[model samples]
Target: MGNTPSRKGYEKQPEKTTLFKKEPTGITYRIPALLYLKDTQTYLAFAEKRSSPSDSDAKILVMRRGSLQNGSIQWSPSQEVTSAFLPEHRTMNPCPVFEKNTKTLFLFFICILSNTPEHRQIITGRNKARLCYVTSSDDGQTWSQAKDLTESVIGKNVRRWATFAVGPGHGIQLESGRLIIPAYAYYVPFKCFSFPIPFTVQPHALSIHSDDFGQTWRMGKMLQRKSCECEMAEIIDHEGRSHLYCNARNTHGHRVEALSESSGAYFDKPRLAPKLVESRHGCQGSVIGFPAPEFVPNDEADSIGGTTSPLSPDTQTWLLFSHPTNKTSRRDMGVYLNRSPLHSSGWDQPWVIHSGPSGYSDLAHSEDVEHFACLMECGKESELEQIAFVSFNLSDVMQTVDKREKKEL
Candidate 1:
């Protein structure tokens, strides 16, 4: 750990390194999703290999593995996971969730027809997306054939939607054996659908969930009003009940946050998270609920999400959110923390990672103690050049805690 000054005092910063950058080849990498497999102590970085920075040019999904050893991370060679797409379709967005009991990983994404752009979808009220996924049994070393779930999972729900997308980042599995994939759909009122609305249709964040593992998945009711490009986390509220917390991008003034009782299915109306800002034109962000370092016990279960620690302000599940810090531009990737999950005001000022030209980041809590990783889009001149993986520690983002409160046992 490296020492850096914080609001409280000197704090430790995790070693940061760049995992991948675009070579001389014109092919660019963007939209990163990260998953940390505790059992294998491996980190999987997934992204889209685009012919250019444009969204419609995505050709294939690519990934690389990073092994944690000693105090540093060793990354493997990049490899193509699959290119299963029709000649006129492109695969994009990679969201992965792991089931501890079954030891299976599910990868979710959407395929968009080449000729149909998002603008056309909203104007015509027709979505040209196919929801699909693949499963891997041995970590990410192997994967099952791609399965198109458009008819089964998104068939009727998308009929009224102008456009929809699965997470471009990681998803979460709750303590009660539920898998939730963060998603969003653009809705146009019937009047707006018939003719071009004054403005582009805003989106609402929703989830595609599975109760009996990943055997069958269902779409959750959309969260209230304009929210998009979301991520979900299982947080233990003050009442000792497990609640699903959602944080999403918004075209409105600020980021949107909401809570759900039945896992990630139904949500309360959303409100702006004042401390979290959405870069102009909106930007995709990532969120996760993690065991507070001071409260985590040595004998905790190995499952991803489960029972809460003894109910207390100090023992509650904490949240970490990542996005760009700039109010008008996508730059200076920042990670914000909220010790109190039930309230939006608990979010602290961010600890910045990339200080320039950064956007669309995903956060993953390290199974290894006191560490976390961020997979982000950044470049020397712009945010779309390449995808990079950065690592940080708890102390880095816990800057506001007083000396005594931030101290580790």
Candidate 2:
């Protein structure tokens, strides 16, 4: 498919982009551009609600598809469907999932603490966060009113910042027709909120099984771990075991994805895998069933948590998507794509799908990456994710730092 003609590459170079536009970076950037699929075609997109390195209040844009066999897409008008209704000081995580059983689309997100300069310098104690939800019946053309899922079950002593804690990054319906939702939670950062005693924070990947589709739910086991680590997505194994994955970042800057086996009921603590992504704090990535090619250089690690991704019916391979940041002050970040063989023992390959104005990336799938017939969000993030232009510049800073690291090393 890449056989198209290359115009006189030796004779010319591409135009230089404006510096102000900046490159993708880990710092000042936050994007979990979600991915979703419609027809056989794929589409990629992100929200304008977040305060990523890009601009504030950006629009949600879809990819342009191919005209021939790969038809292109026109940009849809941006929607203000993020956490704009929440207090301006709060940030959130936006995750989308497609439940095949009910044919329903669920958008799960959580509003969290502000890392703004003022908050960081002046505030003390654990910061409180709230979790919310919204739904789209028509492939995201429009969303149902945003609803608060936190008040329903969650009270206090909980940090919504934990991956999937607000809701599952992705969920699976069991053979018994029970809906299994992936979820996580942890103690707020020691001084994150206003409290006298720091809570015993335990990050985890747990689930909520629903017999009536999301109308009612039951709690699953707490994926046991002494450290904070939880952001779970599902993949049905060849042996019929369900594997739950997420990042476990200890005091070290590096992060490893841990896996747990669940049989619709019980779960084991995450067993560590060699998948090493230099997640400074931690990054969310996603996995689907695309059988991506491979990562030649860094060696694709495991564990990804992004907006939304799914496994193909055959489940031979999985497409994993994410936004990349460096171990240093992340900036000049970009979107990356990767793949892993199902039931195999090796980390999958990775590809760079797209780059952001800043570097907060969430990945989803619809049809294509180059030309989106369907992508949820990768271009930018919603304020629900974080709306700080102040920190947005961190992506630029990360670029400078990474260059220096390579030079020194």
Candidate 3:
């Protein structure tokens, strides 16, 4: 499908409902904030109750479920645990992670500017724009106070912002328990933030590591790519060797998704996928990683595959799922798929997996997307399900169909 005209071509299904939607009670249902969910059994879902989205005042509002489709898995009403920040400073971008060595949960988040400058402080010395984190316990049910980790994890001189500030990238907690994070600097003309002198695009990424859990993080190898806010996954080939996949922004203003060799090393430049999910639009989301029984066709070795990927004849391939859009307000979003023979074919088919509204999702290995988190709906937890909990897991395909059927029911 390399020649597929646009990403929107591959059609599978559409989201009947969002990961979480606004209920009539004025509270917004939340997809789990971040990387906390892994297995099917356990995950924390969250949302905020704000008079408005720009209010910056949000509660740590939390929820948990038992299963993906067991029953009603809606979250608790949004709470105003506004935390210790000032009136303008509130919790934002709350993602969950775990350090296997301690069995402790890591909460990584960015403090969006609300009121004063240096107001939303975390690391105690520098007010970082791109990165910061928090720790958690009991499956993200509660959290440690905010700590501005950007300066500790990313260099402060890397990027710049105007009047207000902007932050760098965020990451996921890998199966190896390595905190894989991405960061970049940029200027938002809307924020009306001024520039230094002659206009220049912000140099994007520098990968970081946290050997001592989230306490003391240091910069590792630099990912000189022009992409920012990368979400990563370790894709093991049929040979069991691991590689990394990241979706990023290139200089061309197109939201391009790329691949890499090592767990988080050299990434191939972003190629023009079939559909362009407007990462530039305010509606951009992350790439949730997945592998399936049918991910790679068995005879993929004979497939018209590219040379960048390993030559794999394996049937099981790895999938990159993203909601690409041609334009921001364009509701005709496609859940596009790019396949690579896990054995070595490189990413093939910039094909379609599902389509509908562009929202958020983390790859949950199962028969259905919604079923992955049903554990939360049932109010129970399982230790065996592999789920990557993102800010929002896309609404389930089956649930969407069932809802359509119920309309007739």
Candidate 4:
């Protein structure tokens, strides 16, 4: 194991507020998705309310509205998203994306048959999940009725997929006004049809994009490498070029990283990130890009092996990733920094945030508040106990990095 710092040395830790607590009646919350509106200084946090901790027990989507007040977040009570559902189906994976031109928020998710597990679909080679979404214009106060897009968006192609799902986290809108939703599909080989005994299912990460607002959406080509639950971010390189970066979960020892030059229409061959090790079976992670900070003289930027400084002539995009730091278990939520996002090997060691059992998490970068916020699953004994929210600034991250360097020396 590397020389990771303990949580005792931090002078000030970010305050964590529980947004959704599990009930005694076995009602639990999981799969967090967060979005920050810079114009209104509002935060919309979303999750799946499940009857139990199992995936097939997911019932509905719940949300909370938080406003920045005096440098702290004031979260409102949780509210069920009544309009984002079908009659007899269970909702999972609340993926929210915002469009600046239409001033609309799109919450995309998958509606699976009640009591039907994903393994069944893979074995039968018949998909039982539907692509759906609901729209909101007033910052999630209300939503439009759920619209089924399975026929329109993925017509005739559903036969190739045994099952699929959208992001369990947030999506992104590009500078050219295109909306990109990270998704993955389980593909069954052609030979499985004739000989159905030994089923072969492969998961590949792809994107569902819309160019003209949210009117029409199309599917992108999947990555050649195997990947699962993933997130995408737009990164501006040192030369002012935009590249769509994908970070995905895999059963391999490390995480999968890929880049797309055409705004996620297609991705290049993926590589394993040696610095970002994965948990046992792999876990969902969140990634977000922000403008690089101004460079200062005598800084230790070279120690991280980054090629571009913060004060480059063109704007540079830096990345923040949240995931479990443990290699064998989903514990100790860690936030990692990448000063050079264009390179796959530029990630630094994570700064351990929550020191206990941790699960799925979503990240949102608020430029207005100058802080990064996260909604995660953490508890004393198990990660499914509660969904909490926390916020921290760049200074907090840098301090942890400096302390780790001193300890190593």
Please rank every candidate by lDDT, starting with the best: 4, 1, 3, 2
* Tens-digit lDDT track of model 1 for 1-409: 1334433234443345565577577688889999999998999999888887778778888889999889668889999887445457898989999988799999888889984778788877778988888899999898888888889987776767888899879999987888999999987655443654646566888999998889999999999778889999999755578899999888776999999987877899789999898877989999988876544322233255543344246435889998988888898777888888788998877776666688888889876477888999876698886677777677556543333353543
Give lDDT for model 3: 0.41
- Residue-level lDDT of model 2, residues 320-368, one tens digit each, is 4333434453332332222343323344322222222223433343333
Q: Higher-lDDT candidate among 1 and 4?
A: 4
Q: Could you estimate the TM-score for every candidate?
A: 0.88, 0.58, 0.62, 0.93
Candidate 2 local accuracy as lDDT?
0.40
Cand. 2 TM to true fold: 0.58
What RMSD does model 2 have? 10.9
Error at 211, model 2, angstroms: 4.1
TM-score attained by model 3: 0.62
- Cand. 4 TM to true fold: 0.93
Candidate 1 residue 173 Cα shift, in angstroms, is 0.5
RMSD of each predicted structure: 5.8, 10.9, 10.3, 4.2
Angstrom error of the Cα, residue 400, model 4: value is 0.8
